[model samples]
Target: MARVSQEHLEARRRQIIQGAARCFSRDGFHGTSMQDIFRETGLSAGAVYRYFPGKEAIIAALANEVLTAVRGAFDDALAGPRPAWPDEIIAEALRRVDDVLLFPPALVIQVWSETFRDPRLAGILHGALIGMADAWAKVVASYQENGLMSADVPPAHVARVLLACAQGFLVQRALLGPLEVQVMSDGLRGLMSMGLRRPPEEEPGADAS
Candidate 1:
């Protein structure tokens, strides 16, 4: 009977997660096995099972971990000191979006592919998306009220559209030969600026239709 300190328990769990990440990144979720994780972590099967029920559980945990970090990063940007201008905030937002893409796209593809067949998994992914969108919508709505964003656009709809666009961009890149992510990201930043910025008033339409 060994009494493990809480710190040691957490360390062991983190070790398992690291091992799982390596295995999944190298071999993918379907290709990985419990024994592979055991070998990677140098942990007994029982010990690993004590922390996670199975492979699916491990994947779910990993997705949650990634999504939580992303949400936290966005919240931090929104809660930062007020920007001098709307473009500043929009630039920061685009930079954050690029940062989110730093993670391997395969991880997201794995989760979504599994979700179609697993109701529990689907629920987890759906809930995360909804929560993220809701939080973003609230922030966008606040900015709109402050005249930092377009008030005509519905916050929730804009949030959803942004997320959909980001996801689509990644998926397309994954399928289409690793398109230049940075260039695409910059273009999206420009698009955000163009849409959110109000044009300067013209003098008597300048005799143009």
Candidate 2:
């Protein structure tokens, strides 16, 4: 038997994932068949199976990829150079949140809808989401340490609240018409301001006493 190189295996895996994304995004998970994956990838049935043991494996792989991408984006946006004013940083981060809401991995919604019916899958999805949220909370904590966050607010709690608002906006728009994206952006900004920006001291450059 010819030994398959690691690079070749990874490439094949990526091809399968891209094909799965296309099928899942268009026909949805339940609607898509293994045949759809084969057709989308232009690979033989045997080759598809060689890459992914089953359809469920493909779906799970896709979900992991999306979660990684989302987490990476959040990290980059949060760690960017601090803005001159605290509000500016909040605004940029809020905009990034809106961008995430606008276009997310199809697998995210797929796994979320199916999780409740399947306990094992629900556990997997929940773990992945909670890990991402925890990573995001750390970034929020940085601002708090720098005194950029408001004195009265809890950084971790605020991170959770902002993430929830972003997710809710996405859910609403998915069920409704092409509503304004800025609505989510503005709402996120308001939440950040309430919990992040410190109140100005009576005197400029003086710490709140």
Candidate 3:
């Protein structure tokens, strides 16, 4: 048999991953089987199995890819000349998620569900979240430096809160049908404006009654 080059091997593995991504996006993780992946990739069982031992492994790879893309979005936004606010960062990340061809945004919902049962998948997601949160913390720290955010708040805590908001947006988009990124951005802006205001109870000269 002719020896396969490393490039050829990597290309074939990518082919399997892309095909599996399509199936998972359409049929979901539990709905998709190895046979579905084989059909999608037009590869025989032996060929597909050579790349991934099972669907869980493929799901893990796809999840990592999606998470990496999200992190890239954060990095890109931060690399700009000016620091981005949370809403701006999220808008860029949403755009990146929309551009991901190998892994659909809806597939992230399936990955989240599977994480509870699969420790490996959970670990991959957990690590990605930590990295992304760290990136967000950098942005938060920048905001504080520029007086856009409070200096008293912990950057890591604020970062995690922003991360949760982004995750919530994803869940809503996946379940609630198509959502406009501008709408989310506007909502975040409104919430941020509200946050900046002093509460009625804290207002100066407010009546005690």
RMSD of each: 5.5, 6.9, 3.3
- Candidate 3 per-residue lDDT over residues 1-209, each given as its tens digit: 99999999989988998899899899888889899999999999999988889999988877777787899988887899998778888888877777764454677788899989999999999889999999999999999999888797899999998899888988898788878888888888888887666688887688888
CA deviation > 4 Å runs, candidate 3? 1-11, 101-104, 193-195, 203-209
Cα lDDT of model 2 by residue, 20-107, tens digit: 7778777888899998889988999998888687777776666556555556666666667852232343344445544432233344
- Candidate 3's clash total is 0
lDDT of each: 0.71, 0.65, 0.86
Model 3 steric clash pairs? none
Candidate achieving the largest lDDT: 3
Taking all chains together, each candidate's TM-score versus the true structure is: 0.75, 0.67, 0.84
Q: Judge candidate 1 at residue 164 and give its lDDT.
A: 75
Model 2 segments more than 4 A misplaced: 1-8, 77-107, 176-187, 190-209
lDDT of 2: 0.65
Candidate maximizing TM-score:
3
Which scores better on TM-score, 1 or 3? 3
Quick one: RMSD of model 2? 6.9
Select the stronger candidate by lDDT from 1 and 2: 1
- lDDT per residue for candidate 1 within 10-124, as digits (tens), equals 8887788768877886798889999999999999999999999888887787667766765765577577775223234334444554454344556667767888887888888
